[model samples]
Target: MTLLDFVFRLSNRVFRPYPFCHSRPDRSLCYHRRYFGLCARCTGMYLAGCLMILSFPFRGELLSPTLNIILGTVLLLPGGIDGTTQMFGSRESNNFLRVVTGLFLGVGVVLFAEGVLFILIG
Candidate 1:
């Protein structure tokens, strides 16, 4: 098979892949959700963000405006800074930090996408 098929098979143990079911890319194929086609880290980030949102529901709103900003920065800044700095050759990236930041970025991506879909369709 392919990388996508390999990952889907591996991640099937944790949770069912989204609805990316199809024999090939065509009019019937979906992209937004990856239809369960994304790899492990992507799925973990999304699942973790969803769990955090559900668990911390009201707490997310209780923070002051500045704290909210800080929280947002904490969740997103590292990924952007690390990726950008590396691109500009300002500093070499640490592997651990890169992975951590990537996870945060992934989480942010899923949360943002889900929020948009919920607002528009739900």
Candidate 2:
């Protein structure tokens, strides 16, 4: 490979992933593992974010900012709340709760991203 290609690959390895959500027992999946190095929900959130980005091209003239904001909140809130609560030590949440929270948070993230893109594009 060329020197530029080698450098690009090295840089990507050094600073590409944006790891975020993580479980105590799964350290390998932590941030920096590359590309939302997290559990299932985190993975979902990342995907949602990508989806939001991908959806940017679909904005019609009739779509309202309020609707977009609502959708974004719905997508992210449950998971964000659950994660924040757990992080703050409110209580030890069970696995089912974790999964549900993660799922919601992921959706919320996607929604938020879409909203931002819509506002900016509009």
Candidate 3:
């Protein structure tokens, strides 16, 4: 097969629903004529997480380790609660809320990881 055809086939396989992403049309973002492989929340999480990681080299040690941990935990709460409630059928969530909470979760995870790393290394 041609390279372009191969790439298309590979993308098709990679973007299939389930496991990584639900790929539900109602919950996914569309670009051009295609829907994203991941749902809105996952897209937000991945986007923010990648951005945060990219900014690591430029970050300063302004916040104390304890403060980092506290802040991280606080940031994580929204996503955690939202996901848990949805999972247990307590409430249904919308895409906007999902993306926002996912963004928080992404940053929170990085901060929490930094805290853990500090504890481990120091």
Candidate 4:
């Protein structure tokens, strides 16, 4: 097949494992139909994660492990609370809220991971 076709097939396979989107494609919230193949929150989270890493060099030094842990926990709480409440059916979540929560979750995860890495490797 053509290169475009091959890439399309590859991406389909790569995103197939997303149970939330793949299993119930109709339930997914996407800005465009083309992005319907993936969960919007996951997309936001990963995109923000990429941005966070990219900005690391220019931003400045990494935070200390203690600070990282505290900051990470603070950042993660909102997402956790929102997600859990939605999962339990207390309320429904919209794409905007999901994206915002996912952004915080992504950065928090990175901070926690970096703190662990520092403790382990340095």
| Candidate 2 local lDDT, 1-122, one digit each (tens) | 76655544554454345335443334223323332224545545556566655666784434466676687687667777776787899965655565566656665665665567768887
| Residue pairs with clashing backbones, model 4 | none
TM-score of each: 0.42, 0.54, 0.79, 0.74
- lDDT pick, better of 1 and 3: 3
Candidate 2's clash total is 6
lDDT of 3 by residue, 1-122 (tens): 66655544554468663487776767766554456666778877877888988998899666777787888999999999998999899989998998998899888888888887887888
Count steric clashes of candidate 1: 2
Cα lDDT tens digits, model 1, 40-105, are 334445555666567555544354444444555567776788768977999866545654675786
The TM-score measured for candidate 1 stands at 0.42
Which 10-residue window of candidate 3 scores lowest in summed lDDT?
3-12
Better of 1 and 3 by TM-score: 3
For each candidate in turn, give its C-alpha RMSD to the true structure in angstroms.
10.3, 7.2, 4.5, 4.1
User: lDDT for each of the candidates?
Assistant: 0.52, 0.56, 0.79, 0.70
Model 1 global lDDT (CA atoms, 0 to 1): 0.52
On a 0 to 100 scale, what is the lDDT of residue 113 in model 1? Answer: 48
Best by lDDT: 3
- Measured by TM-score, the strongest candidate is 3
The CA root-mean-square deviation of candidate 1, after full C-alpha superposition on the true structure, stands at: 10.3
